[model samples]
Target: MNSIFLKAVRNIKTLQYFPTNVVRACGATKSLHTTNVRNDLMEFFDIKKNWNETNIRVGRAWKLDELRIKSNTDLHKLWYVLLKERNMLLTMEQECYEKMNLFPNPERIDKVKESMDNIEKVIRERNIAYYQLETGETGERPVEDVVNLVGLQEKYEKKEYHIPRFMNTRWVQSYLDHGLFNSMAIKKFYRLYREKQHNEERKARNRDMNHVIQLIKRFPDMDMEKLKAEYPNVDIEKAKRSRKSRGHYVPKY
Candidate 1:
């Protein structure tokens, strides 16, 4: 009977210790699992084993037509893959620079970027088609043709506002009531701009005319059709009559 009591006491102690050990084991397992997951995630930024080698070959960028054939879910997943690839390439490049080593195959970065851009374009096309089918709209940013403060036409993207347009005193005054775009200073600037543009055009014409004259003086038997095509803006016939077009030698005309 005494042995039985001692055995019961030992069993009770075992139960107490067992829970503590189990708890510790569970905590260790949880920590190990977390660490494994973290390592897997870090794989996104890792480069290949042969990255440090001299020559690294890679494939071409994802074409738009190829991406278009993929399902939306597949495309979405591919975008993340490309994004990870770009990050990895950038990381590898930075590391190589830090170590004063050559980065292998810089075009890989371009390929990944191109693929990402194509994926986005495909997604956008799908979005537009879906929106048009359901809502009769492209579901893109709404734009309106507007004249800017500089009197130039621009497509103004519509944005959300808290207050009504009429209630916005500062905006109304700047763009409408007391707009500086229509001021006398702007008119003066525009006049000067126009004069500068005219001067440039005049100078360009004179330069081309001079070139045509020089060519004729040098190459008397030059292809007239080719010369005319080369100097479309310059009056070739008028240039031929110029004194500069005549060579130092006696005219063969």
Candidate 2:
């Protein structure tokens, strides 16, 4: 009877210890699982509250000075956040436009664009700095100023060539040959272009001057400041001094 009682007591102790160990193990497992879930959620998306807001008031763009201070990882995270915000704003604006409603503030798009641009600029600056430190080069795309076939100077981005410059007959003929620029056809085209531009300018000047003349003729006491404001380029003082501006009545001098 004594041996049986001792055996029963040992079994009961083992059973009680088993529950305590199991509870501790379960608690540890739950802690590990909760940590993993929190990290996974953080990596997946932004905070939830911004999901359903009619108007999200965000501050201005990240200025270059502000961006310059951020570390690479911080800047990378910021870039994605701004990108998602831009996409969201664009989607909302499109929906609003589709409904034929006015977008409350179209400047929001401009602000987002400015932010993205600043981000890109910051990245580019860092890249250039890294490149220069390691390789002594700005690491930027090369460009050159060249005269086109029409004899107009233009900025051209330079690209690699399989053959040397002297060996490229086609490029040489197109770019170096003065005959292309001095051709009769090109000259005629340029002349016509200039004449068209001149005609447009003349028409605009006459139209504005005539409008000013009518205003002056109708309102002899028209304020010179107001006239100047209305037609900034029209030399108001010269127009007033013109014989056309004189009234029919004799001079009061």
What TM-score does prediction 2 earn? 0.52
TM-score of every prediction relative to native:
0.60, 0.52
- Which clashing pairs does model 1 show? none
Q: Give the number of the best model, judged by TM-score.
A: 1
The global C-alpha lDDT for each of the candidates, from Candidate 1 onward, is 0.84, 0.76
Error of 1 at 17 (Å): 26
TM-score (C-alpha, index-matched) for candidate 1: 0.60
Candidate 2: where is the Cα deviation over 4 Å?
Answer: 1-56, 161-179, 189-253
Judge candidate 1 at residue 241 and give its lDDT: 85
Cα miss at 61, model 1 (Å)? Answer: 1.2
Tens-place lDDT per residue, model 1, 39-134, is: 565565554577658888778999998988899889988888788788888988888899899988889999999899888888889899999999
